[model samples]
Target: MTALVQTVSKSTLLSVVSAIVLGFGIITVAGHVQAATLHDAAHDVRHATGFPCH
Candidate 1:
């Protein structure tokens, strides 16, 4: 039971760390991308989700 608990804890920790790292990486990359690109991506997403951006 103790080993199972340890394994689960380790897996959860790894998942959390991975998510944090991926989020940070995306933010860093997005910062470097062109504003037009980001705007177009956002526009596409809004339309795709039926948000009516325009």
Candidate 2:
């Protein structure tokens, strides 16, 4: 009975950790996408307005 309880507890803990890790990964990817989009927009704006950043 104790072994069974331990197994269940371990499984639950692993599941929770996996979910948290997946959430963090998603957030990181979203942030990267947002940063890339902002960079592209800034590049386009500089070209359009003739503001050199070089």
Candidate 3:
């Protein structure tokens, strides 16, 4: 932990920590969602990104 703090700038560390917290929160919320709802959301994202989900 000390080595990482010494090697990384404050902004970089802050960005990494923020991303980790956001990802964890998304996972936690998604776990409690209905399976059909999750699948629909993922399907919409895939289409939005021009990916072929079907």
* The candidate that achieves the highest TM-score relative to the unseen native structure: 3
Q: Specify the poorest-scoring 10-residue window by lDDT in model 1.
A: 27-36
Q: How much lDDT does each candidate structure score?
A: 0.65, 0.62, 0.70
Supply the global lDDT for candidate 3. 0.70
Winner of 1 and 2 under TM-score: 2
What TM-scores do the predictions have?
A: 0.44, 0.45, 0.51
lDDT, model 1: 0.65
Off by over 4 Å in 1: 1-8, 32-54
Per-residue lDDT, model 3, residue 36, is 74
Between candidates 1 and 3, the one scoring higher on TM-score is: 3
In model 3, the worst 10-residue window by lDDT is 27-36
TM-score of 2: 0.45
- Please report how far candidate 2 places residue 12 from its true position, in Å: 0.4
Better of 1 and 2 by lDDT: 1
Query: lDDT score, residue 19, model 1?
Result: 100
